[model samples]
Structure formats: structure tokens, C-alpha cells
Target: MNDKNSTEPTQPQPPKNNVKGAWNQVCGWMQENLFWTVAYVIALLTTVLVGRELFEGDHSATFREWVLFFLATILFFGAVRFVQIFTSCIREDTQKPGQEGESKEHEILKAKELQKIELQKRSWLIFSYSFMLFALFAALLPFVFDVEQRSAAELSKRPIAVFVGCVDYSTDDEAHSREELRCQLVDSAQSPAPGTQAPKPITSLTQQTSETTPKPGEAKTSDTTDTTKTEYAVITNTTKTMPTDTGIKTEVTREITFHRYSKNGMWIINIGGMVNRCNTDIYCVRGGLSVPLYFVILALFGGAISLTRRIPEYQKQAYPKYIQIDEKRPKLQPNQLREYLVFQIVQFISAPFIAVVAYYLVVPESTVVSVTLGFAAGFASETILLMIRAVMDKLNPSTTRSTQFGSISGYIEHNGQPVKDANIRVIGQQGLEAKSDDSGAFVINSVPPGEHVLEIKHTTGTQSKDVRVNSGQATSCHIKL
Candidate 1:
């Protein structure tokens, strides 16, 4: 018997059949994965198209036009999916020979203007997406390069000063002053010494002298000679009081000489609240990129997270042909529309906005934790909304979602003994009744939150009690029989 069993187990089998079956299974799953792959590809293409609108320049949109084809495919997928979901939910959709409906007019009406308008709308519809994936990705690109490239590239690093100690200006600066430097982005040691102040203007005028001609005393002119003073320097010594450090006004007479200088050689810039300098524009670029990185980037990532979380759900609702669950062609469901599908699409589109709202609710004590929380919030957008409703209910106690139903739990007892098999009915509400067990205990749930009447009946007698039910809390009713 052992030799027979061994021979039976060793019987030759066709290896091709086994390989074929395994290949079939692989193909089935590959098709299913392929659907999602296409959806994600469309998502990528949609982002690219949207980016064209955002970052316009002198570049051919050839690659982007191909992306638009992906958009059309995704829309077709959506239309088909919507119809399938709607049709499956329908109970009865039958056609009778005598009950057929038909249009009265033989020819359908069409307008050229309406057709043109629809075409334009169809063209613009190619760019919208479920989330802002590429925008977030693009926004993060600069920080990797522009913000800290030099520091990151250096091999000898971690000297603390290398990261935080660099400033745009220093006293040793050869040319630029402290306030004048713009794009050095590193410390310098070429400036003038500290406290070497520039010369202050001599405000007090002590005396004025002419510069146009020689003075009368020097020229040996007549004793009564008169000199004409033009706006040009005149040869007159005018005495005036001068400001003194000793608090005494001193008067002095002296000759003043005027010198000519080129207009291009002089300049004065008054530093104000804004410093719009630098050819590289480092500060502005850093400021723009960093704000979004710190405060807004996580929200976008969270939106992406929300997209990831819904992949399975989207797959579930999809037509079998679209989801490709197996190798066999699925029986195509009839096209029908449903309200639930519309809401699901709405949730997908609004996820990014919801994530942005959630971003503000975080306290950024730790950046990693904050970013994680933001992504969590986006992934759990519906959960966050429910939490918000719960908080509102707790705070106000009157919101619609806060309206809670009370429950009832009790038992029947008589003279220190439990009553068995007692029936209980709620008067105010329907379809909610309970019966006591051998232990004389019973519980009623989902009783509308308000005042209610409970009627209890047993072999001995019937007892009725008026009870108060509070929203979201359970009530108790103990009966004596």
C-alpha cells in the first residue's frame, strides 16, 4: 500500500497548466493596479496642465497637450463610473413594450453659439485637480537649492558658525557698508573701523566770502568801490553767529570757497522700511519660499495624504471593468447617476481646502510633529469635521449634529424579588420596546432626547412612569411590580 501511494503522488502533471493559472492570477491583479496607476498618471498630468497656467513662460506646451489627452480619459472614467454606481443602486429598471416613451420632434434642435460655448468650457476644464500635488513639489524645490545649497554642498560643516554665523555685511568689508550690502549672504571683514563716523555738515554759518572775483582790499581798488553780489560767489566777508559747544554763540568773519563737482558723483539713499536691492534677489526669494514651506507646505502634503487614503474607496465604487478585479471581462452595469457619488467627488476636490483649514489648528512646537499632524488632518478630513462638530456641540450644546438621543436601562422587582418576562413599551416613540429577562433587567436604546412616557406590564399589574431624557445621555427607569 505504501508503494502504491508513493507512485500515485509521483504521477506526472502538465507544468504548463500550473504556469498558465499563475499567470492568469498575476494578469488579473496587474490590471487592477493598472487602473489606479492610470488615475495617478492623470493626476500628474493634471498638475502639469495647471502649472502651465501658474508658471507661464516661453516654452512649447507639446508635452502638456499630451497630458490633456489624459484629462479626457479621466473624465471618461468618471462618467462611466458615475453611471455604474447609479445603476447598481437602482431596484427596478424595466421597460415594457407598450410603455415606451419617445420624443415628439423627429429632429433634435442645436445652436451654433451653444456648441461653441460648450467647446470653450470643455477646453478650460482640462486643468483642475483633486489636490495641489505638483505645486507643493515645485514650491519645495527652491529650499533644496536656493535657501541652503552652499552650506549643504560644503564637506567641512557642523561648525555651528558655518550655518548660523554668516551675515551679509561686516566691518572688514572692502567696499559695501553695513547697510549697503545686499547679496553677499556671508560675513565680511573689509569694512571701516567702528565709531569712525562720517563728517557731519557744518550747520552754523559764521561768515560768507565771495569766490567770483578778488576782494577790494587785495585788488587795490578805490576806497569807496562797490562790489556787485551775484548768486555766484561774491568777494564779501559777511559775519554771522556760529553754534558753539560751550553754549556760547560765537561770531566770526571768514572767506568761503566754492568747488564744482559732477552730478553723477554724488548720491544719498535714505534707508526706509523696505530694502529692495540685490541682483540675485536672495532675500525676496527666501522669504517667498520659506513662508509657504513652514506654514502651507504641510497642508498640501496632507491633501496628498487625503488623496492616498481614498484610493481604495475610489476603487470600490468603480465599475469592475475599470477596477479590473480579475482577468474576465466584467458585466457592464447600466449607466445611472447617484447623489452619493457626487458627494464623494466633492469630498475629493475639496480635500486640499479642508487640509488648509486644518493647518491653522496646529501648534508648531515641533516641526516634524506639526507636519505629521497636518497630514493626518488632511487624511482624516471627515474625522476632523466630525470632531469639530462634537466640539461645537460641547461648546454650544444646541448645534444640529449635537442633538443626541437618550437611552433607557432598568429592571422590574417586587418585594426584594425580581420579576421575570415583563414587557415594556415606550409611548412617545415607536419601534422601541423592551422586555425584562429572568433577571428582571432590560435596556432601551436610541430613545429621542426629551421627556417620554414608559409603560411596563407584568402578571400582577401595569406601571407607567414619566421620565426625562437628555440629549446624548442615557436615562434609567426602575419598575416595581
Candidate 2:
């Protein structure tokens, strides 16, 4: 019986290659990147549409609506991806102590790790360039389409019309009284008649003013005619008409129009007792102004193309496919910082363009459509490319793979309670071992995929159990001591 048990070989789980297996894999992939993929498709369509609209005149409001719909979708996905990135960055800041260890592994595994890092750097570099190219394309779009010319012509035809209406008014009597007082004040301020004396101060409402002393060379005047000017147009009282058997009142209405034009950049017009001043020009519109939008688009394209292809000259120094360095770090020492910069620069270049594109798709005549489209393309292209790259990476399997490793993790308990700080040992594999955490959880990583005996030891007692670990799978086991 012992011989039979020792000689037996554990069969590995078959590769998931059936219809169901393919479906599951596809579903899983979609679950991870479906939103991003959809966004990519929409962005591509918008780009094509915008390009078409620039060269052709057949695009209508419906096309703009479709573009807007896609843009909104992209924005939603971008927001979600941004959140995920932020959370992941936060999580990465806190290091997991259990995962780090000094490995006496062979050179080939180390080489593979280096290759993976290199591949990641290349991927990001390519993504950054793609972003910059898209941005450049957006910035130059208006210029290419001669949108400024169209806007100038449109402005000429429209000539900017403004309208105003009375919102409220004071009681009629109150308004008339205020106007009368204003007129009296204006009359009092008028200059005295030439060669006439300044008027003397009045004492009472019925009293006449005394004569003023004239200058030595000028004649004096009694001015008993009441020199103070009178406002004959002032309404002193409100009159009420006789009411009929049925309650009714008469109303009067009038319409007035004024035409005005700007001279030397100044314009003044009155409408509904409100004065408006406006200065208009083509330069006031951002789209009409001469800006190097094309330069931006070119930069994006150049950056995207240059960074994407791995230059043979830089590979050995910048990122080595295999590192002989004794340090645990993968790739060149400076690669991480460069990688981080690439990511940040790509994001910065793409953000504005993304917004512009989204806006343009919805508003066909929008001034910043180019910038928006550029931003949308730049922002989302990275995520789209990442999905493709990930799929490709999985498809291209390494022929030199060593015996694959899997992991086993479980809880150690005592009378249904967690046994904290328990020791876990795997028979025959010195590399496979772990210690239970405060939650009585233990994980033995990089275990050979096969049947293994797990020994759990605590201060109180010990327990043993058999566990089967499949390649690339996490096997769970529970042990009671």
C-alpha cells in the first residue's frame, strides 16, 4: 500500500480548450476590458467622422449626435479607469512584506522577469506616443478644415443681434414723482445767464428771492420772474377714470426701434431703458485666432511613433532583455522613473484633447472641437492599446518555460477560532512554506503543481492535511488543530 501511494502520479487539470473553455476565457477577458474596448471603437469612429467632415460636407446634425454619444461613453470609461488607476497607485504605496524574498532561482527565471519589465516599458512608450499624435491631430484640425474662415463668414452674415425687455417697473405715480424731482435738480444746476447776477437763496415756499449783488462791471438783477427753471412736462398727480358697470381699464402700448453701429471699436445702443456696449472681432473667437494647433498634433504623432518602436541602440543600456545584476529589481535602475514620466506626460497631453473631442462630437460647430477630439483620442488610446497588448502577451507563450508553479492558501483554526501565528510546512519542498497571520491565513506561493502534504503547527497542537495545487491556480485548504 505504501509503495503504491508513493509511486502514484497526480494528473494535472486539462487545459481549458473546449467551447465552454474558450467562452469562459473570452468572457473573462471582456469583463476586464470590455468598457475600454467599446470606448476605443467609439473613439475610432469619431476620429474617422471628424476627418470626413473636414474634407466633405455631407455630415449633418445626426452625425454630430452620434459623435457626442461616443464621446460621452469615452468620458464615462475614462473616469472609471482614472479611479482604478488612483486606487491601484494607493495600494502600491503599501508594500506587502510576505511577497518579497531572496530567491536562489536559476538565471532563466530572472531573465524572464527582466523581459516582462522591458515589454511593459515598451508598451507604455508606444502608448505615450500614440497619445501625443492624437493630441496634435486635434490641435491642427481647425486649421486643416479652415474652420476659422467659416466662422468669420458666419459672423459677417449674423452680425450678432441682441434683444432686451423690461423686467419690472415702480408704481406710475412714484416713478413720475422721482422724474419731477430729478428735473428740478437739473434746472437748479444750470449756469447763471451771462452778465446776470447769481441768484440769492430763497427763504420760504411762497417768498421771493432777494436780488443778488452783481460784479463791478456787470448789471444786477431782481430776477423776481423766479429765475429757477420749471419743468412743465412733470406729472404732479394721477387721475382715475370713472369705472363702468363691469370692471375694465384702458391700456396703451408703443413700440420704438433704434439702429446703431460700432465706430473705432465702440458701440452704444439703448433698448428697454438699458444701454449696451459691445466690441466684436474675429480674433475674439478662439477658433478664428491663428494658433499652432497642427504643431500640437504633430508632436503627439511623433512622440507616439518614436516611443513605440524599441530602438536597438537604447535597448542594451536603457532596458536590457536580461539583467545579470544581483539586485532584486528588474530592468535598468532608471527605467521606473522614465516609465512613470511617460505615463504622466501621456495623460497630460491627452486630457484636454479628450474633452474637446467629446464636446465636438455633440456640437458640430463647436470652436474647440479639434482640441476635444485630440484629447479624447489621446486619453483613451492607451487603454485601448493596453487591452490589445495584454491579449497578445497571453497568446505568445514562452517555449522555454520551466515546471510551472502554483500556490496554496488556507486558514488554521482551533475549536472554530483562528489560530494566529501558526507555522505551515510543505513536505519535500523547502521553498514551499508559510506562517499564519493574525486572521489564521497562510499562503504558500510558487509551489510545484501536484499533491502536497501540509503540516500546520501551533502552540496548542499540530495538524496535517493533503492538498492538490493546480498550475496557475490558487488552491484553498482548511486545517483544524
Candidate 3:
């Protein structure tokens, strides 16, 4: 019985997380992949050098910080993704068994290839872990790595605040271009008055209302008091009795509720959608401060792909037993997010050009059509990448991009509104006529750089306007008819 038990394989225990052991392993891995490690280091240094200008702009400090954050996130996660892909390929290739009837020389070459591939797998895992941390450090240095706004007071330190509510112009008959929205505030600290401090959160407020009347012709009743608390307004109840001239007594009850607010607690605040950083302000609790939370939400979807299962390998398979361990699958950590981001980047590159090409073929007026085209670019990112690669390969290495032709992009308005389907033509320039979309926007490319007269055609009639196109620059045209 003892011998039989000993011979039977014991189930392997799951590996426990060992930080120190993992650190040592990572050091060894980086040493093995020194060339790739150096390349990543160079990329990190370059990003910091380039990102310095983000701080100098007065355009919008909040917007600039968000840009820096985005760049940092992209670089870090991108490195992680690339490393995973490299490791996956190496692991897959090394696992593959060589042909059964191969020559001696082929076998020797295969052995060398397998050895190189094995080293790659180890090095890539290290690169991903290390670079991901480094990238996070670079991006989070501004905010000190704490993005969560735990309390209303912390909101003062955040960059952006998005105001969402109905416009409150307060007695204005006509709406204007800017926003004057009175949004509910989480903490008054965000938008502070010069001398006032944030009001303390109202923990509790209580009020009660009751009527005292002799039950249809019964006797009078005594006064009573009741107390309870909730988070809202505070109301005071008052009753007054006066002697009547007819020798009868009359009783009256009244209740008044007034608005309560604090600089420290939840209060009504005015925020403009596209308005002021302000002379003074009030900020409510919006998770993640002034940051565009929708963008953050959308970003989560990019890295949400699940990791795929490894292909099952049999014990008696042609591949060596050492490649896999104890019939256990060595799970690769990344879910191909890095490779996916590459696809996204390629699609981003192609989208504008794709839209331009499509516009030339058919000038679409519907925004849905444009959005669908963008979606198509993302969905078929691999195809777009392949096409871009093909174009890059075909282009002459010595050729430089010269502004041989200029473009024109602008809007045609009927009074203040966009004139849809209005045609704008470069007089005597064949195939250069472009029709405006719903927003009165139009783009015309490949127009020769020179002074030209544009003819705008609508239901009413044609109007001519003179414009000059600079080399490789878009000429802005806003026609008010």
C-alpha cells in the first residue's frame, strides 16, 4: 500500500506569490534581454524629454495634464502588451515539435532556434513587468499616484471639473454661447468664496407638522413636541392663538422651509460647461474630480480582454516533456492588450485618411456614416495595419513629402445656421467641387496653391468669393449668406 501511494503522482500545489523570488527572477531576465531593455530605457527617457512642454502651456492646464496622463498610461501599458506578445510567440514556437524525418543539420538549427526562443520568453516577461511600473511612475509623478477622491476636500487639488446640469442664466431671455449651470456640489471647498470656508456636512435635520382641531365639536387639545432627523432642510413650526371679538378662541399653524448649504458639505454650485476657471466657484462630488470620466470609462474597455487558454499538450506528445510541467498550463498574464493597442494606433492613423478617401468617393451628410467608418477602421485594424505596411514598403526610401497641393476646409452658413448640401466649387478646377455636410463643413484636397475664386451654390443661387491657398495649409472658408 505504501509503495502504491508513493508511485501515484501527488497533485501539484498552486504556486504562491513570492515577491522576493520574483524580483530576483526579473533581474536575471533583464540581464538576458539587455538589448531590448536598453531600447525601452531610451523610449522612457525620450517620453519625459518630450512631455516637458505639457507643463508650459497656458492653453488649459487641466487639458494638458490629462494629455500627459494619457501618454504615460499608453506608454506603460503598451510596453506590457508588446512584451506579452513577444513571450507568447516565443513560447508557442519553442513548444512546436520539429519534423520527424529531418536532416542532422536541420535538427541542429532547430535546437539553436529553440534555445533562442526560450531566452526570449523569459526576457519578455521581465520587460513587461518592469516597463509597466516605470511608465506608471512617470505618469503619476504629477498627482503622486493617488487618483481617487476620497472626500470633498480632496477635490480642490484635482485638475478638471465637468459640470452637468440645465443652464441657469437666471432671468436671461435668450441663451448665450457660454454655460451657467448650477450643479449640486459635494464639497464647497472646490469652488471657494474669498473669505468663507466650506460648510460642515449637515448630519441631521428634523421637522414635524400636525393639525390640532377639536374633533368636530369636541374639546381643545394640549401642545406637544416631537423630534427626528434626516439629511435635508431644517423647518421651524409655529402656532399662534388669538382671542376673537365674538369671545371665541382661534388657533393658526404655519411652517416655513429654507435652503441650507455649507462650504464643506454638499451644496448647490454654479459651473459652466465651457465657462470659467472662475473668480469663484462651487464644486460637487464627481468621482475623479474634473477629469472627463467618460474617457476613463472608455479606456477601461481597451484592456478588458480575457486571457486565452493554452493549447492542451499530451504527456506522450512529440515535444520534449520539460517544455511543459506536470500537465499544468503555464498561464501567460497578458490578454493580448499590447498587440491590440498596436492595432488601435494603426486604425487611429488611418481613420482621417480613410474618411478623406470616402469623402472623395461619396460626401456623406449623416454623422452615423462617419462614425460607422471610424468603427470599421477600428474593427478591421489588422487589415488597415497591413495596408499601411504595404504602402510604407512600396514608398521610395529617398522620397520626402513635399507640399505639392494645398487643401481647403470650411463652412458655408445661411445667416447663422449651417447650409446643408451647399456646393462649393473651385472655378475651372475639374473635380474640385465639394458639397457641405449638415454642419456646413466641407473639405477639398489636391487644389493647386494659388489665388482662386470659389463659387458657392445653394437653392437660392451662386455667390463668388476670392481666397488664397498656402502650400500644404488648409484655407478656412466661412461664408455667411
Candidate 4:
């Protein structure tokens, strides 16, 4: 009977298959959470419309018009929420289990639910991200398009021209006293009298002495006479006096010049002018790649996080032990290690190249290179985390892998509760294992299908046991470590 039992082939267990049902469950959850989707859509549409009007509408619109526009937007959003709630409730009723061809119906319902959920989620997210992007664009718009004005004052001072001729006069006492005696005769002629002729011009003493010339045969005497004459005259003069203390104070104003293109429903405002000023004040309205690039970068990081979650290491799984063991096995050859190291070096060096490209092609001119460098550094940190996880798994088989070279089972404990992240190994064999998750239970799936001698090594000590494995079937044993 024992030989027959051993000879009979055991049935291969069916592969676990519940993924479709799990997807349906997720879809159902999203269908029930429609409020977030509706709110997001309403907010996004309102922002876009209002932002457009603000940019393009006539400047003549009053504050009251703006208030009314905002109020109407609020009412529209509220109405959308009401409709969303009603439709969502109807969807929930249709999703209940047990109807004709129930499984098929469930699948169909699930598909519809998933579609609605995805539409709402994506629409809302796009709206939100786009609104933020537009707001940033608008805020920076004014800086690019406006012109500046400048003013200045100036003053100058200098001396005016006087006369450019010489004056004649005498200060000698003999000349002045002799001229005074002649002046008395002139004064007598100037006295008021009937039939007074103009006074004869006074002649110098030298002229008077020379007036009598020597006649023919008259005795000639050698005599020389020298006399100087002084002239008195009154001169009119004008003088300019400057203030004792004076200073110049200058005031300057500056403005910038630029152009802007604005749009409203059907109206377009193209304002192009120069702002002039004397001082240093700069104003510019710029529209370029930076704002959009920022949003794109943000989306990229979010996508990275989502991608990380998709990896088996991070995803939730029922039998994580088997997966961890498979991942940690010594599969890489020595050459592969060299390749990996080379890859790491290449990745580390490529960051600067990527930043240079982004600065020139993706980032705006106003953005500093330092900001680009910082972004690159943050990306490098994430890459390092991935590398560390891979490297540690390669180096420590006992700590990181799960396999059954020799079978032994144990319960992990910490302060009387089960401890996770604990290491357990079989002595004198390349047999190593670890617990899965926060639960201290583990199973090693790599051992040969047969009874075997096993030793359990823990942090404190080691214990021995005998275990058996059936082909394709797991054998269970329990111990405290």
C-alpha cells in the first residue's frame, strides 16, 4: 500500500488566479468616490474661463462685473456637484451583486465603473495641474509686456564778459597839482554867462611852452621841459553777485519698454509701447518655456513615484516570501557586478550632461543654473536608493534571501510579540532565509522535495529538527527564535 501511494502521481495545484476580481474591486471603490472628480472639473473650467476674461476682456469692465462673473461660476460648480451625486448613486445601485448572468453582469458593470472613475480622476487632475500652470503664466505675463518712463532735471552756471580795453591815469602829485590850476580856469569858463562860448580845450604844459617858436636870427637856448597830465573821468559799472551757499539736487525716474499680446473671448489687446525713465527700474512681461517646464517636471516626478509603486518590491502581495527569495538569489555572475559598477559610474556622471541640456532646451532664460543643479541632485538621491537596495540584496544572502537548503521553521518574537526583519539560517550550508513583512512567519521554497536534516540558527543560538517536503507541496513546522 505504501509503495502504491508513493508511485501514484500527485496532482499539480492550480495556479492562483484572482487578479480580475481584484481589479473589479478597485474600480468599484473609485466609482463610489465621485465627489472629488466633480469638484475638480468644475474648479478647473471656472479658472480657465475667468483667467481668459481677465487677460482679454475690455479694461472698461467694472468691479461689479467681475463680482457677478465669480458668483455665476460658483453656482455652476454647485449644480455640477448635485448632478454628479445623483448619477453616482444610480451607478451604485446597478453594481449590486446577484442578477441574471451575475458574473458577466458584474464584469460589465465593473468595466463601466472603471471608465467613469478613470475619466473623472484624469479630468480633475488635468484641470488642477493646468490651472496652476496657467496661473503662473499669468502672474509672469505682466512683467514681460509693460514699458517704463523716466524724467530728469539739469542746471549750469558761469561768469559773463566785462570790458576788454586799457585805462589811462596819473598818480603823481606834481601832475595832479599842475592840472588843478588849469581846472580853475575851466571852471570860470563854465560859470553861467550871456553869450558864453564853449571853453577852449586845456593844453598840456609841454604844448604851451613849445607854442612860442624861435624867430629868424633869434638867440637859441637849449632847454628841455617834461610834464605829465592826469585825466579824471567817472565810469559807470555793473556787478553780478552769487549767493554765498548754493547746491544742485537732481531727481531721476526710470521706466522699461516692452510689448504684450492679450486675448479675450473674441477680443485681442496688442499693447506695444516704450516706458521711459532716467533711473534704474526694470519691468518686463515674459512668456516662455519655464512655466510649462516646471509643470512637466512635476508631472515627471509624480510618474516616477507611480512607477516605483508598480514594481513587485513595493506592491502588496499575498506570498511575499516566495517573491523576495526569488529576487535575492545569487543570480549575478562576477562579470555582472563589474557591469553594474560601470553603470553606476555612468549614471553619476551623466547628471551634469542632462542638466546642461535641460538648461538650454527646456528651462527658461531667467531660470538660474543653480536651480537645475539642485533638481539633478534630488534625482540622483532617488537613483541611489534603488542602487542600495539592489547591492545589499546581492551581498547578504543570509540576511536578504529566502531558500530551503535545509528545512527549519521558527516564530520571530520581539518583547513577546512576533518580530519582523529577523534573520534565520541553516548551519554548514548555503541555506539562508528571512521573514516576510511585519509578521515573523516565513517559508523557504527552494529545498529539494524530501525529508532532510535541518538546523535553525538565530541571533541567540541554534536548534536542530527533521523536516519533509512533498513535490510541489509546502511542509509546515513552527519554532520560537
Q: Pick the candidate with the highest TM-score.
A: 1
Model 4 lDDT, residue 22, Cα = 91
Listed in order, each prediction's TM-score against the native is 0.29, 0.28, 0.26, 0.21
Q: After superposition, how far is residue 454 of candidate 1 from its true place, in Å?
A: 22
Q: Between candidates 1 and 3, which one is better according to lDDT? A: 3
Top of the candidates by lDDT:
3
lDDT of each residue in 1-481, candidate 1, tens digit only: 3664454545787567888889999778668767655655566676666666644778665554545554555555554444433333332112112223544341132233334433432222222223224334433543543233232214122221111111123345424222221223311222435888532222122342322322222222212222333221233454343333333332334432221111111011111112211111122111110112333445445555554444334434433225435423221222111232244445545554555455434334465765665555545566767756776677874545656788899988976789888878776476789988989999899888877767676766555666888888888777776
lDDT for each residue of candidate 4 in 303-408, tens digit (9 for 90 to 100)? 3332233222221221112232453432222222223322332333343334333433332333354344335432453443454466667787565444344344
TM-score of 4: 0.21
lDDT pick, better of 2 and 4: 2
How close to the true structure is residue 430 of candidate 2, measured as C-alpha lDDT? Answer: 71
Go through the candidates in order and give the clash count of each.
9, 19, 12, 21
How well does candidate 1 match the true structure in TM-score terms? 0.29
lDDT of each: 0.44, 0.45, 0.47, 0.37
Model 3, poorest ten-residue lDDT window? 306-315
Give the least accurate 10-residue stretch of model 1, judged by summed lDDT. 260-269
Regions more than 4 Å wrong, model 4: 1-102, 132-136, 139-143, 147-481
Candidate 1 residue pairs in clash (backbone atoms < 3 Å): 83-336, 171-191, 172-189, 172-190, 172-191, 173-190, 173-191, 210-234, 210-235
| Stretches > 4 Å off in candidate 3 | 1-103, 131-182, 185-272, 275-281, 284-481
